[model samples]
Target: MAKVKLKKLTKKFKEVLAVGNISLDIEDGEFLTLVGPSGCGKSTTLRLIAGLENPTQGDIYIDGQKVNDLPPQKRNVSMVFQSYALFPHMSVESNLAFGLKIKKKSAREKQEKIRWAIDLLGLSGFEKRLPKELSGGERQRVALGRALVLEPKVLLLDEPLSNLDAKLRLRMRTELKRLHKKIKTTIIYVTHDQAEAMTLSDRLAVMRDGKILQVGTPEEIYQKPKDVFCAGFIGSPPMNFISGEKVPQVKDKNIMVGIRPEHLSVSLTKIAQAIPGKTSVTETLGSDNYLYVDISDQLISVRLKPDERIPEDKSVWLFPHQGKLHLFDKTTGKRI
Candidate 1:
């Protein structure tokens, strides 16, 4: 229920700059995700907001109040880490009631809150179960419920679903989206999984080397990436890049042309304006097939329907869809 803001926030670990100067504004009740590769400072940024780590420079504001000098307990923020830090020996209800007990809430108040959390998280039958008795997903919910019982003004999650199996992770994603809608609390999430970030965030801040490369909605970043790294990173199959000089349609030699796998079509025969290549491999993933074509020693992937099949080592041609090409500077890798 609060808006968070960062002004030139920075953190340095002696010789290493963990988080470079960066500014961001998270709207009230909005879910914002920071996504990037490992060591990209996404986790560091989340820790700064949670008061788990102090920033080297700049300020953090929550609900328009400067919180850079405040301790984590006084900041009204709750964080869930990659590992579900649940109390191993405690029952689910006890885990949920621990924070309320620390704050010395009345017995009735604690019971009411614990019941609410259990019901909210769909754990009605598992209240007496310990962490060891619960499934991975159930245990994760206990950790989340423990955080929620405190009614924090802001919730921070750092790769909270990374430990779950793929199917369980998908289910958790759906649960998180539903939870956000019901509570409307401001959430700042950090993860390296682009698919997870895209599924859960209202806005995404793509980071690289301790700096934010771009910030936008999932569709915005996917359809119109501002730079080469973003263009290559956000998609499942990822966008394919080719030297502009190798493309007959491109006039600039000092640039690179990017076409997503879905934006390129595979053809066995040469066509008008087609780029010739030899088929390298094909990957069938239930609903869709991905064809890899080697063009001038560079492999380009093309999306195909599940029914479509192309032989390996077969000569093929590629045709880019109109208006789908992305242009970037060869030297700087910036969008052109």
Candidate 2:
């Protein structure tokens, strides 16, 4: 495993700044994830660390050694791309052995490495199968195996599970976590999915535009978001925002109050100190119902129990749970 560090990293295209001055440290044997929307520079940051893209400014260090000028092959890092990037014509065994072959490992050493990777990735019987013969999940394992055989100090995964279906993606997430525990390899995973980041990472670095918004554990980022952007971006249904005027308790005139969907309760009967609204829609998931209510002219969502149902166009009252409100300055969008 390796400790990777980025110091004031910045990357720029001709007239566009892809990555702003950002510094981050990934501990050895830690599973860290970078998450954000498209064009947010999360992938660009990963590419810079992988030596796939050169930084216009700043420095990169791997295990305390400056590697900003080193080629990717010499960086002791392995990257699994979003597409898996497996060789279509090569068998699983051949693909796993390719990197070792380039390094000129002895026959016995090569065989041992291949065996380890195959067994570790649970590709025992599929060694002879070509990429086309394997399922998406299996092919992904092979792609991972190829990287594992190289024994890289740091492993970088760029949304490797994005191509799989929902069930397969969930299965792969568990498998990836298991693999990490077994090998104890340092991993830097990049994804646009907040759910993936929440589940897979020991720590998450949330990015937007060309800068990092915040870095913390999933729980920290969720429960105590530093800004409105983070609070809005990290949740499933997302936190509901109401202007200060709509919520009179908020004293700051230039502030917005945010209440999570799960933090608001709905009542069919009129209730004192409750916000009145008309139910616009209700979506039933397996375990819960999401109610979209139109209050004044703004729409706010509330999470309710599966049994709770309010007919569309029916009047309802919304009561925010005390102490669960999040306040942000409207001008800066910073937490207040």
Candidate 3:
């Protein structure tokens, strides 16, 4: 395992800047994920690190050694792409052993490594099956095994779970986390799915247009985002951003307050210690309720308690948890 560091790394495809000047330090043995929407340069950066694409500028280091001139084969990294990139005619064992064979390992060593890899990935029975004969999850496992057998210093996964169905994706996610824990290799994963990033990563770097917007644990990025874009990006139903001024009530002006869905409290009337609002609409989600309220000339969402239900087709009062509110610089879109 190795610490991967990118110092002001940049990649440009002629006129368009694929990756802006970016810098990040992925700790050794850390399951670090790079997450963002499409065109955010997550994949570009990953490619640069893998030496699949050369950076337009900047330096890349693996364990303190500059590897800017090294090719992908010399980088000591394995890439697991979205496509799974499996050989159609090769059986699982052959597929896993192909790389070692090319590197000219001894026959006994190849057999030993293949056996160990198959067992490690629970692919013992499927070693003789070709990619076409295997299920999606099994094929994915084969791809993982192939990468793992290489014993790469770092593992680069680019949206490896995107091909799986929803149920399988969820299952594979748990399996991927388990694999990471057991292998203890430095992993840099790139994905658009925030939930996957949150669940699998020890630390996640949120990217936008080739720049890292924020880097933190899932809780930190969710509960305390550095800006509005991050607050809006990493959640389901996301955090609500209403264009409201600093409604000075008691202390400092809580200007451009951000309230997560779960941090809001709904009631028949506004509480004495919270901001007042008129209910716009309420969505019932079986165990929980979502209340949309017009407060301070903006609409915000509130999460209702388990046993509570919103009175239908009528305006209700909402009390926002002031302590949970996040204040931001409206002009700069930065946390205040």
Candidate 4:
């Protein structure tokens, strides 16, 4: 296992600065995920760490040693790419042994490592199968095995489960979590799927337009986002926001009022639990429902639990929990 530290890391492509002045610390044996939307530079960041791309500036350190100048092999990090990147003609066992072979390990050592990885990834019966013969999830596991058999210090996974079916992806994610726990190696995974990131990571680094927006545990990122972008990005259905002018009694200064849908309430009768508003739309989701309400010129979402009497669309009172409301500075979008 290794601790990785990225300091003032910058990457540029022509005129575009893809990752700028980014600094992060990944603890030894920790599972860290980088998650963002497309073109948000997550994959690029992982590439830099793997020595697949040269940094324009700054440094990358692993186990207290600077590695920006080190080649991928010299840096001793293994990468599992999004595409799986397995050789179509090579058997799983052959692919798993390819890396060890390059390092010139003895025949006995290579075979032992390959056997261990194949069994560990539950691919024993599929050892002789070529990449094309395997399912997408199976191929992904093979890719992981290829990387793991090398037993490098840091493991980098770039949306490794993106190609699988939904159910397979979910199953693979649980397996990956278990694998990480068992190996206890430093892992850096990159993905655009927020749910995957939330479920797999010990901590997450949220990126936007080449900048680090916020870095925190899933709970911190969800419950106390640093900015409006992050608050909206981390949650399912996102967070509901409303613009409000200064009212010392309600809150201070101009703020972007945020209330998680679950934090707001809707009722047919006036309720003292939250502020009053009118329902504009009621969406039923089987288990629960959402009531979009207009409050002081703002739209707020209130979640309704099972079998609650659906309120009339004409007018329904909205109550936002005072303690649950988040205030962000209007101009900078940062939490205030």
| Winning candidate number (lDDT) | 1
Residue lDDT tens for model 4, 1-336: 999999999999998999999999999999999999998888889999999999999999999999988889999899988877888889988888888888878899888898899888999899888999998888889999989988989999998998899999999999999999999989999999999999999999999998889999999999999999999999876798776542222554578877799986666776554456666877888787877777778776678766666655556666666688788898999998
**Candidate 4 global TM-score:** 0.93
Number of clashing pairs per prediction, in order: 0, 0, 0, 2
Once fitted onto the true fold, the runs of candidate 3 whose alpha carbons sit more than 4 angstroms away are 246-254, 270-288, 294-299
Off by over 4 Å in 4: 245-253, 271-288, 294-299, 309-312
Best by TM-score: 1
Worst 10-residue lDDT window, candidate 3 = 245-254
TM-score of 2: 0.97
**Pairs clashing in candidate 2?**
none
Instruction: Name the lDDT value of residue 325 in candidate 3.
Output: 74
Q: Global lDDT of each model?
A: 0.93, 0.92, 0.85, 0.87
For model 1, what is the alpha-carbon lDDT of residue 59? Answer: 98
TM-scores for the candidates: 0.98, 0.97, 0.93, 0.93
TM-score, model 1 to reference: 0.98
What is the Cα-based lDDT of residue 167 in candidate 3?
96
